[model samples]
Target: MQRVLIRSIFKLSNQHATKPYLLQQHQQEARINSISCYYCVYSSKRGQQENDGWGKSKRHFISLLTLGIGLGGIGTAYILAKEVSALEKTATNNDTHENWHKERRTDLPTYKQEQITKHDTLEKRVWVTYGVGVYDITEFIPKHPGSDKIMLGAGSAIDPFWHIYQQHNNKEILTLLESYRIGNLDKADEVSTEDMGSPWGNEPKRHPLLKPASERPFNAEPPLSLLAENFLTPNEFFYVRNHLPVPVIDAEGYELDIEIEESDTTRSFTLEEIKKLPKVTVTAAVMCGGNRRSEMTEVKPVKGLSWSGGAVGNAKWSGAKLRDILLAMGVESDEKRHVIFEGCDLDPTSHPYGASIPLSKAMDERGDVILAYEMNGETINRDHGFPLRAIVPGTVGARNVKWLSRIIISDSESSSHWQQNDYKGFSPSTDWDTVDFTKSPAIQAMPVTSAICSPSQGEKVQIVNGCINVKGYAWSGGGRRIVRVDLTSDGGETWHVAELEQEDLPDGRHYGWSLWSAKLPVPSGCKQVEIWSKAVDSAYNTQPESFKYTWNLRGVLSNAYHRVKVEIE
Candidate 1:
């Protein structure tokens, strides 16, 4: 049997290269050539048997590898509400400029139909307005909360984007919009990505403690894979993680200034030159540094976004290797320990989001790190750091800075608070008053971690021999493999090892997450069974049971125990 193995779902940073293994062993004469096609072990389609150590986990990883078989009818139309034929009437009689406007007008205006949520996605158009200036909201309809019918107008407009919703737009619309806000509280453009701290996308919209990274924030999340369906979210989902406003980095005159103290040289790579490097594709995940931060709120009222695990995504990243370029520019190695990355945006909080890796991690043959230009096969969107972004695989989301303009190679780490005081794990008893930021290094590669992404609490499970099967993912930090995943039914008293899914990735790093499943046997005398599981990395690191022990005032790196309870047969 197979268990889906999921390592921490975010991306992993490292490097690896392998020769493709041949599927067929025999060679034939140029003309005699009639050999049957054979499946090759090294085919891009072949998955490794890395999870064999955990027999069950191996099965799951192998079976589910099929889940990501390949790309299909992508970039195709997914319009749901209503279909349109030709314009009710022909184009305007005006032959020039007016004709273009006619081509853009919709044949049908209002759509009031609802879509069936058969695939867990609304898959229909929905509409919302700031004032006027209509946009096709089809892409955002599924992510909204105004009820299914509200999505009908996704391709058109209902008015309210710029002008405040007065009598025309009331409380019901406001409430519905607020609920599906993906979390932020204000108008998406004006609040999260705005600049000037104005009522709309503006500069100076810095947080009470932050500095604007740019004049405008790119508020998008890149896709999780290279498959066609991820066109919108490709390698770059314009980043929107601003305590402030978006930045404005001009594509024409922008210069990437990199300082390498090793060779005592400073070099610059024009936006054009950097994009020309030999390209590489990486299927990696980038997660918010504050993902699932709300779980900590359960124990105490923390300050950051109470995000509940939706802040991360995966993508096929293509860019230049920072190390290769550094070496080419004569980056030196002496008294130095690590290399620090700085972003174009800076916040007053002393943390505009940054992280670092062992200089070795950067120079490793497997480190596929890069300064990305394209996301999901398209030009980087404005919301994501257009022009440039650092793709640090399998690392914290914050380190993958958007709108990047600076790169420094030195002996010290970054000075940003995110790379210093926050994003770390402290002792259980540590509190704001006594916690020492220096005591904990900024979090880099994460720890062996797992989460129940689906099957919410109170959800029913099938019973077999008084048992229920549990499924989830497990992952570890650095290059450490998840050696074992133990599931405890009834809290911490007793446990059983869950099965593991696939084990290796195309890049040859066993770093990708593995899905898992376990048939938990019901306790003989208990009314209910509480399920909890912990992952052990190759280095033997395991997650703690509660955030109380690991919690810091900043609420960084909360890899505590994850527990779920269900009724038993």
Candidate 2:
């Protein structure tokens, strides 16, 4: 029995380090401990039975106990150390990109494709080469955190940003970007490392159409008129609001780790593994919580990205259901309150992008939340989360996190700064000095909103037969449908019912926008026309007539009636 117990300890030690090298070292320690235990037990028992040698037996017993305890302790410690080292090695090997080209360069594109891929304006074919690799980035241009700054590399090399943005130098970014890899750049055309000096010097080219908010962590929106041109906003024209520089992820190495609150086990899923699950496609609109914030500044100079009405877009997304994945991962149906999502993108301050949604909303069969890999029928581009992203339909854009890396089912909300300190609403009396974020809940489902896209602010319009045409988009959150759109040529005194263009969707499932147009007669002999538009939803939600009563310190949820003035010269 004693020998069997010692053998069991040795067997346990072997389990700690399964790697051949570490296992060998651990086995050697186990053998020594086993030998010592056997000799000590055998000698101590034999000495106890000899009555005439009592004095010597006492000394033997004492020594036997010390040797057995000390050697057992040493063996246990060595086994633990080896186990930890093995775990560290696994993480290191998974993330390293050394010799990446030699191992994963099979499907790259040629030099001719790189040159012809430039000029995305017509064919909408955007490609860029980085370190002898080519990537198609057309889908990412509009959703890019820097907006059109990404366009500067269209049909060209990414060397300019690579040299200037020090963050892109790491292996994680190189691996993350591999998911978008289509082909290889010809060796001769690839920029040599010696010649790839920082030419732009941290300054990226700004998009001509975007109104600059801040130059460094680029923030901008397209001109208001261009935003209303299409029901589905073009990717390039979509407004971008970013809190950090974008992160590149190796598509092959990407994993979405889910922490099951019940089991306390973090299970990992690859992008391909997620793709194989049952697919769900949703058409939804994602609008920034700060969309139309610039108008709120008119009430008071509030602090935030200066955005107009252009900060929203509708897209079709395809991916595995978040609810399905969570259930399959063994999370108890009743265990969580909020489902927290974390993105791989990190700020210099070491904060990863994060948000949380109510568990009720996340698990609702009709909620349509997904771990999306494809946007608009194509694989998601790198700038917008190449391998995977979370699409929470009809929610604020911030909650629809990009570069998603983790899904946590928990009883409490996320502790992220974005969730705790920002994106919440405040009363009209609230000011920066006296405001408390905890007093108000975070802004979720956006309020009923509409924006005038045509006859842009301060434009001249020709009155043909005393009539002027007006057009724009209207949408509401919480699955509410836009029931009516009112257009006014004379500032709400007399309203014209605009004809709404929309798809025939099921009842209680309207999540996209409605493009409306109306031909309203110009007031007799007026030199200028003031056009105002507001939409009414099925729930009777409508925009405020003025922004003054609704203005808050953070400049959020600006849903006032959209007004544009045009001269009738």
Candidate 3:
């Protein structure tokens, strides 16, 4: 039987070598594994077959069956191990090859020529460029959060679409993209003529969640959801209401000029010299006077940047007290006088950005006003006035001058347009053509205001467990604490008290906003819920019941009870 098996094997091999049978597509890879296993079993059972052909056949059959199972299992294990090792080696080599190409690509030609190198179709060779960096996003494309949206720019410049989908402007997102960078973009590529006239041409990147009110003067506010997350807003997420392009300043050369009209002395203090003065810290909320202007516009057309309810933030400011500085300058406590602040940021006319508060507000011992260089524990960023700025704790945001370059103590108020004409309140009967700027005073402390951040305006709310969650921030200017927040889903027909994220202060001096949240039961057959929130401050001040009576031409001081509509789907 052994001799026969050997002769049969030899004959089969010769026949196969001369005219080999092709394997089916699926069996191609496993054909060798099967052939090797048969050879291994037959070789191990060679000596077991003995005696006459019939007896040998019986013995060989039994032996072959027993050894085939054991030897086949061992052969399969060996093949699997070999295949895995080969795969690992191939992956290592591919990674090393990719790294080498990345290093080489870094030294390649400028972005002008390289911008055309975007090739995203191939599995392991996809490439794209954003800003000044070229990246190999082949592996990342499949795992991208935005999925196929990224594929639209697979082999092309993604900047145009990135501008529209602003979420890509985030620092964490940029850093993640940088990890895949293969090269730097060319520095010589001129600005595309198509985008030259765009208002956002040279604007600094902002947090994508912010709603833009204007692109030229650069005003924006964070989403209300983010505004109420922390007691002190992160500097990056803070509201920006710039009247001009943010000034580029050098801290080493930066100076704060203090001009005293009474003393006829002008003193200039460098950033370092200003730091040497006694430091003080204060926590306050800076809210734009135009906050919620859009709500007022619903009642009547108003003239101003179309701001929403997010143009406000609370932060910790650290700097030298303005009162101390005034005392050092020997300023007289006169109510008729004013303290003016001028920012380095200049408008198109080259006029310095300026505003002023009454001398009493500036000199009040408890006002907590300061020449702030730090916001929320870090040096201010360029967007929020780098090097130095001013913080007026309980005043309108316009009075908190950014990039503070000069401070003037004078008997007259700031003659800047922002002070004399803009940022002042007007009567509801006043029209743009019939307005008298002199009749109204500049807005100082804000009115008690609250806005529902969740269940956004015109949002569809799912009835989860038969209830909906409502959340918002409420605060009053002049350090007035929010004592109560009332919420209603039936258009003020009934009200439920919202629980504050942090309990209200016993001292009734909470300057920052209170994050109020509550879950209200949905009425059985209600197809729509008109959600409303109104806050009561420590002074018993509450937002007006209607905006019709509060509407003004400039849209300042629009503190109406906030309303949002939600459809029950």
Candidate 4:
């Protein structure tokens, strides 16, 4: 088998040695076509020899060599074959090479660091390295959930970017990436994981009580039982939804940049300067757009962190009101413009997290937008955006950019990936391949949502006076107060109104969530009961009966009837 492999390499080299190194585009195309044809014939021949165990291995070896020739030339293919033979002879069972040498197959072609860099352009080809594997992701770029952000890893290692967006660090994504693998990276060119220090090394300590949805970017929410225990969620128990490592900033040296795009004027304000401005406190509930994504996944698999009912929290945020600051700066409000907020937390490419709200919302007296420095009457911690943060009351949490650094007034919306591609809703029938992000507007204010928190799913409950006590929280966005909460103990067959503890804010300015409790009647001789809750907002908007119709690719804005099953005692 070894002699045959060597002879094949020499024969291919001789055949291509006379060709003048494929400089023309037509010549490259012809070379690729010929190599592909050769691969098909070679594979068919190997398929016929099923009796020999070496046939399958030989086919993989030939496939890698042909891919190399198509990518570079015959000389590159020769080098790749030699590297594979060398690896097979000397590769050990160490942690570094275990995955690469799996299944006793070490015939994967190898490419140099510089060779991978040359294929960076989409026109040429898009290649990226993860560990020792090199993948051609050009075909997958358009289908990437994060949109063109995947291009940032072109001609480079995707390890760093995965460090920021840890959701991609899963088996399903790995399997998809493996289908695009064309070769392995040369061992000499491999960068050890230890050498690439962790981006999350500076992350702040978090409360142990918070249940994490992910650990690297550190997304977590409070336990549902503890969520509605108080009207104002405790700072330590407040849910955290981070997209990147928490940025470390010096509070004393912090500066917020304010940019006016029309005039191209920029101004900086120090922490002290911002503190000098009049401070206002607004009690608001910030909820993740995918708060109930886990439940949606039960109906159908969705793409996002699997948050339960605890991703929403109410707090008193204290900071300089955005309207007051804009007025003092002599900025003119235009409804057609947008107020963009950028966070200091950056991705692998140094792009800060950003989002935008309409200028009308920023300037509206009742909008209640603020550059918050305190939460729940205490100094904001690093996990919650320490030095400064944007508090866009009644808006999705994505728009409330934390680690607040810059504010831009522009005529257009933010160009951030989260703004343009993510955090948007789509039709239930719209799948990932057919979904057009631009067609759907970004989620701003959320709809009415309620959940049953106290009984805890699958817990055994004792019937007291033919009724079971229930407690949970209900909220709506855009200052649309939750007007009513209804509970059903028998699959919506009958309903009982829940008594709500609501804030005394005026109409259209009720930003905080409402805590509700009820005593639901249980049917006689029942072994189990399913509890459901739904809320009605000020505009009479109520949650959908089920997540089936509300399902989308990204699972944002999933406000369905919250349900939990319990065993009757």
Candidate 5:
């Protein structure tokens, strides 16, 4: 019986050898059960023991010796399991790039510029340089989001391209690029900064009041208080969301090319000719897809610019109606087709920034889509896409392509990097590693959102007659009107309706934002109070209560409840 019990214990330990922690627990339980069984058997047979003290003592000694052997076997199994687990963990760490710092190679080979140039083609294998590092990007070519755009840097340095596409300057992309590092560029062949002239050298001057989010591409927005002050945001105070350096366009020489994909025919329109067309005015709000992203980041870290609520502004845009232009050009609109807009803003490789909108929206009489040339009754400034820009009302700012250079009526959307890859939302769980941009559709109409413009996050408010006044803006995409704005001072325990000041426009045609203000009674004896505001659109869509539920990896469409904690005196 002792020999059988020892064999069973060894078998159980071997079965769970790979799971050290689990095996230890199971082994301990088995030992207790086996000892209990031995005691039961010994007690039952005790009456049958010989009537001699020496015989009983010998039997007890054997039982203890057997028990010791079982315990010894368990200890040995535990030690072996522990060693195996450690070895497995070491092997995993060796395979992952997380430990790259510990095992990074230092003896990389060096290659000259001429050598890199030789491997530019697929047949020769594509190679590119960044700074002093030479990388073999042959395998990454097919997987690149920009597709053939990456091939432009095949045999040369990609520093210029990366300078234009600053989004690639992130850690994830840099680390992924480093993984394909084959060698270092020879010191003598390194490109000088002088040779790579700044593309942003001719950038137009911007208003100091417009807070800068980025300098190179020149993204800026006005202060929230200043933004809420004007129903028609001043041309200079309007938010600027440029993705590329301002293009130096000659107003007299500027030409817009219109192409029909189905007919393979093209037509050109000069700035004067575009102005001669019937002019129309649109009062709308252009909000960046990443507006209020800073709030989302508080819930969980996300990619893209950390934009505040200021990345939005309402303006009166004047331009030639796109629908009328298309009809006059003898181009028939189809629901299945798309109106692709290309901007003159180009990267180092001359790839223009582009985006597309549904033909249905472009052709809709109420859509108000236009080829805008004037902002706030003044000639459009260079920073705001002077000469020509696409005014895509009720759509995300990304679709409103700036510096309009070309328009294409196509069955498919634009093949630009921004349209195909960027400005898309994803599940909070979908991180960079597992993100598949193709799976998610590009964001178009934005969600309902609102923010407190006055009495900023930590501002002190004077209670007038036991009530604190709150002011903010509320808006929704798809021409949805702000039906109601709700304010709560006691964490949504009670709600107060805010008076909405909106344009008197037809339902579903309310393209502008609704400025709302409310006076809430302060909780008795509360020194600090948090005020939360949310808006309901005409479509009955409302802002989410918490950012956690609406969080996305790219941080787009972050329209959660706006909360501000203020001190009451």
Candidate 6:
């Protein structure tokens, strides 16, 4: 069999040396894993090194089995293949084929349906990139979690581009794309030639079965493990907080119009130019101001997404400095007091939109503000932001606008109800009947906040004397690194300084959330362990227990100390 394999390899090599077989067409790379498949390690090269002829038979049999399992026949495969080819042709065409665009391509499977089938959707809801080139919407470019970086391969499949950089959006990426006009797209006659791997290959199979997202979760309560990691959250696990419907933009005609009040001037930066700036990246968390709104439901019915402390996410954001770009545009501040940003998502009000930050926060050093273009070393996810978005460290989440468009440098705050009427903390007694939006300022830098990320609040533990591991995350506002995390096992009486991971952990160690661990000596004869934790910000702002004093009609600034309980053996 081994000799036969060698002879067969030589024969195939001789035939290839004499006549060129149809070459595999390359597609734009949208993610890292795509690159691995392109450099196939299990191909004829390896087969030749082993069983030559017999190994070739074995491989052919496997390929046949795979194709059978993937699609019922070669015909369905060809139809799927043709659509991918058309998308590439559309991208490379030099003429305006906007008329050629006959349907909403996005509605089609994001990647080939076969790739989606590879994953066991019967269990978990992993991100399924099911199509050819990534959907590029130029108008929506600036509003991505990674901001303009999503437009990196504006006129081609993004699959090829994502493989080049482990950290791309972090650098100036104007040259990210060779060109942007899709009308001149080159024609491709086939779908990608890479073989699909196991759908459930990398994910863990032990966790409780995850129901389809469209179906309601088994429990609306937030999971404990989610809050432990502060950065680079797994794309699937990142908390989602959407205020309005996500907008889909057309990449070819997308334009960002900045109406400069002074000089009565309007300058436009195509999705391409915005990405050309010297790329920079910062690590921060975008936590909703009312992160724990569901907790407030106990006091009074709140009027917002019933979020259980899970509406925040942390990530390494890479893009241009919004301040640098504004300076280059010759934006004369004229003593501008604030810079208001408007996103595409809005409600039914006359101009229902989003909020803003002060000029100092918007354009300061510690602010580390960015017009983000990438997340987790890839272009922003469609759900997060596809084009442009703001990244403010330690600030409440409402200010991070997705689907970004306009930039207004003004002296006053945003007129959006979100800015003036919400996200402000007030006395616990304050309610709809007696509260005033003007009574408080827009919430900015978050107070020292910490949460128990394990051992669900009322979790039952095996009554062993083994150490009960206590884990959580800590953060402070205004670029203040989490200086310390104090864990009190006896409800604030006896305290232990927990161990914290300052850098990257094996899981989500750095770039987003700071992790803390406490090894409590499982006490003797204790039926329950009352756990409490607090953090001190750079400014030494500590969380006041209970939202009694931190409450507002809008339920903002709910940074109360997180407490949990567990039973002993």
Clashing pairs in 4: none
Question: Candidate 2 vs candidate 6: which has greater TM-score?
Answer: 2
Question: What lDDT, from 0 to 1, does candidate 4 have?
Answer: 0.72
List the global CA lDDT of all models.
0.46, 0.62, 0.63, 0.72, 0.70, 0.49
**What TM-score does candidate 1 reach?**
0.55
Lowest lDDT sum, 10 consecutive residues, model 1, at: 64-73
What is the lDDT, from 0 to 100, of the residue 331 in candidate 4? 85
lDDT of 4 by residue, 265-310 (tens): 8788887899899999999999999899899999877767788989
List TM-scores for all candidates, in order: 0.55, 0.64, 0.64, 0.82, 0.77, 0.59
**Which regions of candidate 4 are displaced past 4 Å?**
1-105, 163-170
Error of 2 at 258 (Å): 1.0
Q: Where does candidate 3 clash, by residue pair?
A: 111-186, 132-185
Regarding lDDT, does 1 or 6 come out ahead?
6
Arrange candidates by TM-score, highest first: which order?
A: 4, 5, 2, 3, 6, 1
Residue-wise C-alpha lDDT for candidate 3, range 1-569, written one tens digit per residue: 11101011111121122112212113222122112101112222212311111111111100000001111101100000111122122212334332322232323334332233335575425556565555555543332222233454554444433322232344333434444555554444221213212213334678887777755456788887777678678887888887654555557766777889977987778889889989888777889988999989889766566788999988888999888888888886777999999876533222466789888877887777889888888987878877788888778888899888778999898877677666888789876435666688887788999998887877788888888988888888887878899988777778999988643444334666778888977787899988888999888989899999988867888888898888888
Lowest summed lDDT window (length 10), candidate 4: 1-10
lDDT of 1 by residue, 263-349 (tens): 667777778888787777655556565555667768864434445544555455667778778778765444446766655443311
Candidates ranked by lDDT = 4, 5, 3, 2, 6, 1
Reference-based lDDT, residue 51, model 3:
19
- Candidate 5 TM-score over all chains jointly: 0.77
lDDT of 5 by residue, 446-560 (tens): 9999998888888898999889988999999999999999999999899999998899998778999999888888788899999999999998999999999889866899899
Q: What is candidate 2's lDDT per residue for 1-569, written digit by digit as tens?
A: 12111111222122112212212222333221111111012211211111111122111100000000111101100000111122122222334553332232543325443243434452546666565666554443342222233454566555433432333434533443444456665554444434322212322244588776544344667787776677666655666655444443557766777885655877788888999999988888888888888888888766566788878877778999998987776654553488888776443222356889887777877888899998778887654565788888878887888778778888888876667766887888876445666678876788999998888888888888888988888988877889999889897789888999876776456878788888888799899888999999988988899999999866889999888889997
Alpha-carbon error at 330 in model 5, in Å? 2.2
